[model samples]
Target: MNFGPPLTTRETPAQRAQGELILGFKRLGAVTKIDTLFQQGALKARLPRPQDPTLCEAVTLNISGGVAGGDALDTMVTLAPGAQLALASQAAERIYRTPGPAARIRTRLIVQEGARLDYLPQETILFDRFALDRELDIDLQGDAEFVGVETLLFGRQAMGEIVQSGSLRDRIRLRHDGRLVFQDATRLEGGIAAQLQRRTVADGARAVAGLIIAGPEAAHKLDSLRAVLNAAPGIVAGASAFDNMIFARLLAPDGASLRQCLISALEACRERRKLPRVWQG
Candidate 1:
């Protein structure tokens, strides 16, 4: 009944875990639909019936349960002209300790003219000794709208876990009309918990997150977005706008605080529309 590797074998590198998912959405007349979907290994995408017929919502499932060292996962998404879609996950992703190499995750997103895409995946939990390398790239063509969210937790506060040591490399790149407009990266290694505890670093926060809204209307909404974040407690948050984009980052004591602030702040970016129903669960 024990499906995992035995204690003796756990120390060895886990090389068999790999997953990939590719999805495409397009608008035909008045409706947005999934035009292409491909799944390999342990990654799958599911589309739910939406209240708004013009929008496509997809929730991805990870059959492998969690990511381990030496694991490789890749995801790519595309939205054609005039299409609207929101991409989210069923639950938080967990990256476990790896005695061997680091786990790698690569993601690419493409949005054509007049299209709208919301990237709202859940949090990623980093466990002690975990080694992970992740990157995300977004390509926007013409006038497109995009809202993205990324949250990271050092460990689960409810589970009383502590990430005393680990390594992580995270990067993000954004391009508009084939020109790169935004880039960000985060790298942490060795004594992760201690490094984050520094006052100049994270101020002992256990969770960190970033939200971005890019479109013609993005910069104009900065004031309203910051207003929502100002009232949030148990967190330190700030927002900035440039080149028709609104970027905000937050550090919180736990996941609960981060989620609460996001719910309200995201509403401003979404034009008052609620987030994906899956996020509620």
Candidate 2:
């Protein structure tokens, strides 16, 4: 067996490449109908199996493959009257290290008259030195309803790795019948993660998750919902109902605890609204 050029432990000469990706969807129907599509790097939308045909629940979307580094993902979802939709990732969204520039994710949602939609995706975990910017824009009709949740973790806490480096920026805007309801932006850098770990700041927290629930019954569930929030363990959570919508917020050290709190709060709200738990697991 002949060996190649003097096996050097360190190789030299390198090449770099860059690319972009986008994923989108739209709904079309008068009463309980949906149309969807997606396009991304090495990812495509597959036809979902029909289940419980009579229910007015929205179509479910799952990201089967992980979003790779150096790949940008953009998604647009629309819902029509009497129709609803839900979107989620099959697993946690991983932001890998990129040799080029920062990765991006942008999502736009439109809800038509008397429709409902839920945009509950999986948690996003950022590795060391991973850079990402995400923006979410939501538009709802006057009588439409929308619920969404986003969970963010700085790094893999199980490895005892602290998010000492990296950058995460997120922006969100919600509009109801052309009326703005919520706007939030977070830019973390320059030891911000360490500052968040402080009790005075985030109370030794490592994860943050929030829920935006808006609809007709959102006005009367604050008291009962707050009671449920007070009972969840290992979480600091609260619920507020006013202005025809209810919002719930949760902060925890990990994703499991935060998800539990969200599930409980969701169930409580569903009960309060006399509606079935539409969250399909």
Residue-wise lDDT of candidate 1 within 1-281, one digit each (tens)? 65886556446644557889999999999999999999999889999887577778999988899999988999999999999998999999999988878999999999999999999999999999999999999999888999999999999999999999999999999999988899989999999989999988799999999999999889988999988899898879999999889889899999998998998988887987668898876
Task: List model 2 lDDT by residue over 83-202, tens digit each.
Answer: 755555555677765444666777788888777676667678776667778899989887887778888876678777676666667898888888888887877755756778776657
Task: Output the lDDT of residue 58, model 2.
Answer: 29
User: TM-score of each candidate?
Assistant: 0.94, 0.78
Q: Which candidate is the best by TM-score?
A: 1
Q: What are the RMSDs of all candidates, in order?
A: 5.1, 5.1
Weakest 10 consecutive residues of candidate 1 by summed lDDT = 7-16
